[model samples]
Target: MSERHVTFDMIVQAVGAVAGITHHEIMVAGRAGADERVHLRYACWWLASKMTSLGPSAVGRLSGGRDHTMVIHGQRRAEELRATSESFRLSTDALLGTLQALERAGLLRFAVTIDPLATARRVLSAPEREAVRVSTYEIVAMSRLIVEQADGDPSEPSTEETAHAA
Candidate 1:
């Protein structure tokens, strides 16, 4: 598949769409513990760092002007979560898949290949393959939710609770 240049904004937007969260929520300055907003922010940082040529520092700047250390920490945490948490891994993998599908369909301005496992492994200190519990139905549902949100569907799940659920 042909790869396309995916912008930071595009990555943030797509991830936000799949996660049922918003860019504002992610970029908002805060040290909110391990909440959904924080999770989304970290996921955004990890995705941006991988999907683009931007370094940790640039990713930090885009993500609320966070310091490189903070970006690094977030990336490390994301890697840890991806390796240890099945739900977290599925959520992240699903978002990446959604972005890839969007790119391939030309719904996005560019086309990009996103290999979640490979990307995560690239950042992981110790990578291990775990059986994925996510079914095709769940992935399709996540994709549908993302598409609806992107289309500005009024019925889209945008509530904080719904966003947290993803």
Candidate 2:
């Protein structure tokens, strides 16, 4: 099996796709008013925690700048739902299975080393960390723009072409 670094963004996108919600809805800060939205967000957290090498804080950072405690709570809620709800378990399991399939197909990637302190080592200062976080958001936004411009067709011109034409 080929290894790929499955990013936190990938998990969020996958969860959003599976749940029929936008990634924006999942990543938006604040308490989601809808139970479905809350549960989907929790599922994203649980999946990211389980699937990636990122720590809770890193996962939280990638997930709408949430606190580690909030990530932990979401994880716990997800686990509780999985234990008690067969439908929830089946859905999550299906999502997990889809990700696993992608991994096996060499489409999805995962971290190489499972370093516990990786998050700490990645950012030396709070300002640096925030910068990195902002960059991530920008990257995601750019990706969305590119995808939107592509419009499900690979033969389409690139983003630059579209921009230049405008």
Candidate 3:
């Protein structure tokens, strides 16, 4: 068989795609000086964000290849770096955008399902209004929401919700 190719970038892409998340410039290698800790810490953030386990304990556990203190140190350093570094900020935005794009491209996570039944009142059309009355109220994915605008809030309404009301 021809050699099946596998690389860190490919692995990260696969992981990200399966998680309904996205990332870019997935480099796997040794780091130099400050970059070493920064990269590992960044990886921790990226992975935890994808897993949505950003709590202190969860992140500490996940990032613990070294001592938990090291993970904490990295996390603190990254937070500090973000405070004053414009270039880092731009790079972070770019990386996050790549992840989001990968998600939209169906590379990282499962498709988000939609919710059909809503608790909306006086906001939907006559047909939608009636539909909600009969539909049971529950959480919905609602991937595609197309409704006429009413006030600023889509879920709530007030006297001002309908300016057309006389």
Over 4 Å off in model 1, which ranges? 1-4, 31-34, 110-166
Report clash pairs, candidate 2.
4-109, 4-110, 5-109, 5-110, 6-109, 6-110
- Model 3 lDDT on a 0 to 1 scale: 0.41
Q: Per-residue lDDT tens digits of candidate 1, residues 18-92? A: 767666656665565338777777788777766667788877766656899998998889999899989988988
| Residue-by-residue lDDT tens digits, candidate 2, 2-70 | 344666677877887887766666666446457788888888888877677677898776665689999
User: Weakest 10 consecutive residues, lDDT, candidate 1?
Assistant: 110-119
Give the number of the best model, judged by TM-score. 2
Q: Across residues 16-97, which tens digit of lDDT does each residue of candidate 3 receive?
A: 4543433221222234443643553454454334434334454443332245555566556656666777765555555555
Best by lDDT: 2
- TM-scores of the models, in the given order? 0.58, 0.64, 0.37
Q: Estimate every model's Cα lDDT from 0 to 1.
A: 0.67, 0.69, 0.41
Candidate 1 has a TM-score of 0.58
Q: Rank the candidates by lDDT, best first.
A: 2, 1, 3
Q: lDDT at 103 for candidate 3?
A: 53
What local lDDT score does residue 12 receive in model 3, on the 0 to 100 scale? Answer: 40
RMSD of 2: 8.5
